[model samples]
Target: MSLSFERTQSVGIIGGGPGGYEAALAAAQLGAEVTLVERAGVGGSAVITDVVPSKSLIATADSAVAISEASDLGVQLFATSDVGRPLAPQIAINLAAVNRRLLSLAGQQSDDLRGQLVDAGVRIISGHGRLDGERAIVASTGPGGTDFDRIEADTIVVAVGASPRELPTARPDGERILTWTQLYDMKALPDHLIVVGSGVTGAEFASAYMNLGAQVTLISSRERVLPGEDRDAAAVIEKVFTRGGMTVLSTSRADSVVRDGDGVLVTLSDGRTVSGSHCLLAVGSIPNTKDLGLEDAGVQLTDSGHIQVNRVARTSVPNIYAAGDCTTFVPLASVASMQGRTAVFHALGDTVIPLEQRRIAANIFTAPEIATVGHSEQDLEDGTVRGFVHKLPLSANARAKMMGVRDGFVKIIASEGSGTVIGGVIVAPKASELIYPIAIAVERRLTVDQLSRVFAVFPSLTASITDVARAMHIVGSDDES
Candidate 1:
């Protein structure tokens, strides 16, 4: 059954993250009366604290790296003294200014998104919102939770995002021991920063601070950094991190983080200790699903506290839906937005497709970014899937040579029998941008021959993608012969 676009329905969205706001906007577009309730800023953590702020910091670090490499490109960056020795160029970072700019950008983005929602006729409520019953949403205005406004909606979208998880032994004081959000508020850079956790967040922060001229020590509890990511990509990043003067401590776990006078000390699980000026705990995140009265509303939650939802974002309750970091195992802003839109569409009785995690492209925002889509090499090794794989090193590409990029490569995986592009991984500078084509191919189920035939710019990073596709095609053809 298809719902009419002109049909008027009410949607109450809790939280203003990518998932919540996007759902509100999508529902409004479908001619639904939308109400968005948020306790903090409109953009959620993705804008205010997590994704935007971190990327902004990474941009600054990237600029510093570019400037450092300018001399190698014959760009006269510094002047030589009379004795033929180059004068020392002073390079310094004003943490206060950098943080101020980051906050400003985040605020601007939030304000812009808020403006868009308002213009689209979605009502914005500033408070903590939750399910009062099965179909009613109650928003408490103050910290006391006294004053409240009740809204009756045909549908409810729970998009309250997650917060950084802290260990009992190493709580974030938001000062010397910090979470990802608190790092932006730092007034001064740490002289020696120890980042605990080797996931995407940890690796990115470690890379950024190292490029920003800090002595960084990265602790990985697993065998390697980004253990969940492509092994080749992780190896490249580890190599880069080590070469950049970062101490990559693999197979190490922080037992506790304690403040020691003017510095911090991180005690490993093995009883050994590493001292640093500051320690960042990027272990993981816990979904913000408690105190929402979800159980009372008949919404089921997973053991990990995430609201249990189907592909279309429907919770166990017929009218309640959940999206974003709170519900998704893959906590990405883009995925959150898609889930939100899907939920709104499904709730309104519109035709919609369930989200396919396999087609989702994820990128790690490090200096040399790692992007992957669809089937992973692990899937093949584990015999979970059968596919043909082809890899091309970026070092062999002309553009890479020009840019002095010798690290990273592109790997493509195609279905064995049909030769359809099933998955790919890219590790390089701007790998994020390069992964989209592979994602498109995977989503559309395009054949390797079709992907290989598409023209890419000569002497470009993207040429390597086409090269990989062509190589896969050739290998497939050889097997047929």
Candidate 2:
């Protein structure tokens, strides 16, 4: 079925996240009347709570780490006061101010996105929106809950996003026991923070808090942190985390967390207990699909409650679509935006390119960030595909040496015969910035030899990427010779 653009069609979007906002903009550009319904601020959790706030906090922690190492660069920081002998230079964190700035930045970003959507001629509605039917949405607005707006549209896009999953045994009280979002309200840094779960969220928060001068204990149910990430990258991060005085408990699971007077106690399934001033729950996320009248509207959802969607973001109902965390398993904001745009294009009868999950790039915002794109070593081992691996340590890079970075490496995977770069992983400081070229290489099907031919800046972290590609090229040459 194709959309008839003979007349102006209305597009109703439920959620104002990357997915919803992007879809709204795309639909507007396609000459469709768009109305975006968002219960929170525009830009969703990416701008308001989850991605932007967390990354901003990590940025502050990164600054603190840089300052602590300033003396190593011959920039001495000394105590100025003297009376009863000599004083020592110390790093002090004003967590209140830091959190305030984080929230302020997030708020500003949300406002900017809202302004952009407004300029694009998309109507913004502040309320909880649900599917009234296949082609209509009902928005519940205001404190009284009596006023409601019924919006009818030719196409409906759901991008309500997801929320932090709460364990049945332990629920967040927003105080000593908290989810990641509640951390910004803290007046002071946690004295001893216990982070539950070892996924990307947990690792990032654990690393950030440790750098922020908090004693951290990371509890992982798996053999290592980031069980889903590249093994070498996870190992390097674990090593850095341990070397930085953070305790890592592997192969241990937290059964529950309870308030213990002034602190919190996390009990493991093995009957062991861990006490900390605060506990951050980063177990995972649950799709925000409940009470949305989705099933009633004939929308199919996965067993895990995610909206089942096609590559073009079509739901079971032809006129209805889903994107972002609401439908995608890989919940990166960039992917969400792409999926949203794809949905809008398909709905408006425009040519569309479906999102390729394998080509999606994701980053863990730890001190030495871990970023990856395309295939992984695990996939190769599982015989999912054929590839050759080449690794280059960051220590071997001139830029890493100048920055005193000895941890992390860049790993690339290429096809056996063609030597096309299929995937790559980068673990280093600012790895997020360095992974883009590799992502482009993977997406564009650039062979290792072709990637090596691209000029990279001297004394730069990106040099490591080209170096790995060049090494792979030489290996391929040797095999041919």
Name the TM-score of candidate 2.
0.97
C-alpha lDDT values of all predictions: 0.91, 0.92
Query: lDDT of model 2 at residue 83?
Result: 70
Worst 10 residues of 2 by lDDT: 472-481
Each model's Cα RMSD: 2.4, 2.5
Report the C-alpha lDDT of model 1 over 65-107, residue by residue, as the tens digit: 8888777777756668999998768568888899999999999
TM-score of candidate 1 on Cα atoms, chains taken together = 0.96
Check candidate 2 and list the clashing pairs: none
Go through the candidates in order and give the clash count of each.
Answer: 0, 0
Candidate 2 lDDT by residue in tens digits, 357-465? 7889999999799999999988899999898899999989998889888798999999888898999999988888999999999998888888888889998999888
